[model samples]
Target: MELQTITIKREDYVSIVEINHPPANTLSSQTITELREAFQILKDDIDTHAIIVTGAGRFFVAGADIKEFTEAFGDYDAAFAMAEAGQALCDEIEQMKKPVIAAINGAALGGGLELSMACHLRLAAEDAVLGLPELNLGLIPAFGGTQRLRKLVDMPTALEMILSSKQVKGKEAAEIGLVQAAVKGDELMDTALTLANSLVAGKSMTSVKRALECVVQGADEALEHGLERERVKFAELFLTDDAKEGITAFVEKRKPDFKHQ
Candidate 1:
């Protein structure tokens, strides 16, 4: 499909999706639609074991396109649709079988930060800024940000960040568990790639996908239910060829060749 706002590149088993919108890289409706399409394609791409998302210039994504908000003003249904669209895209990214990593090279505010939060992993540049500043615009985060931020950090921290419209640097974000790691600007992409590779290299994608499902899909469920789901998945994995090979390799003391079955 033709994409105007994003570019997809392949590096071996990894797919790097870069937001190419200039200026602020704001998430206009067109940009969001293109992103959904790109990710949908990558989700089924067997060659792409993992994915990394980043932006083109100084801004990862400044925020959603405030200009578009004007079109929805005074129309509750239109506003609701906009919010639902953003939430659906985030939910899709969060539930992907293949891992998705956010390489935050620059500012990630409002919808940008929300998008990063939905990824399986996030690595931000030391100077990168991240926050949900929707409140500052007389609005609130409508893209699962409120829920994910609370789960990532403490409730109090999330409340404070949202209420105060506070933007934290990457280092502070890592300290609060908003991001996995913070590296220098020049090292952000390299660090993200290293992390993405480490997560899938020499590992069974079957196991990786199940583990992600247990964590992401079960996060909102009761502890008992989550454990039950994990147990069921664990037993189910044993029936797969990759799982059998992995166990045998453990006994043979050698790396198992995984076909990702």
Candidate 2:
């Protein structure tokens, strides 16, 4: 697809998706649609083993386009649709088989933070700022932020951040487990790429796919149910060719050459 709001670049097995919306890189309707399309394509691409998302300019996505909010104002249906759209996109990202990493080079506020939260992993620049500042604009996070924030941080901290419209620097974000790590601005992309590559380095795509499913689909369920799911998947993997090769290679004391079958 011809992307107008984002750019996609391939680096061996990793696809770097950069939001190019100028200034603050706010998420407009077009930007959201384009992102959804881009990810959909990447999801099925065999050449891509992982994905990294970042922003072009100084902002990693400041927020949703405030101007678009005006169009949905006073229309309950319109506003509800908008929220659903954003939530759906985030859910897709969260459930993808291949891991997605957010390289937060600058500010990640409102929808931006929500987007990063959707990723399986996140790396931010030390100077990067992240938060859900919708309350400052007489609004609240509508794109799964209310649910995801509490999962990352405690209820009290999430409540305080949202209610007070607080923004945290990347270091504090890491301390609170909001992001995995924080590095220098110049090292953000390299760190993200390294993390992404490490996830798929010597693994079979079949195993990778099932592991992601086990975690994403099972995390929200009861312990018994999650265990049962994991057990079933573990048994099923034994039937795959990759599993046989991996087991035999262990016996031979050599690296297993995975065909990603």
Q: In terms of lDDT, which candidate is strongest? A: 1
Q: Measure candidate 1: CA RMSD.
A: 0.9
Question: Can you give the lDDT of residue 167 in candidate 1?
Answer: 93
Overlapping backbone residue pairs in candidate 1 total 0
Candidate 1 overall Cα lDDT vs. reference?
0.94
Rate residue 132 of model 2 by lDDT: 97
- How far is 131's C-alpha from truth in model 1 (Å)? 1.4
> Clash totals for all models, in order?
0, 0
TM-score each candidate: 0.98, 0.98
Model 1 Cα lDDT, one tens digit per residue, 1-261 = 799999999988999999989899999999999999999999889999999999999999999999999998799999999999999999999999999999999999999999999999999999999999999889999988999999999999999999999999999999999999999999998898899999899999999999999998888889999999999999999889999999999999999999899
Q: What is the C-alpha RMSD of each candidate to the true structure, in Å?
A: 0.9, 0.9
| Per-residue accuracy of model 2 over 18-132 as CA lDDT, tens digit each | 9999988999989999999999999999999999999998999999999999998799999998898899889999999999999999999999999999999999999999999
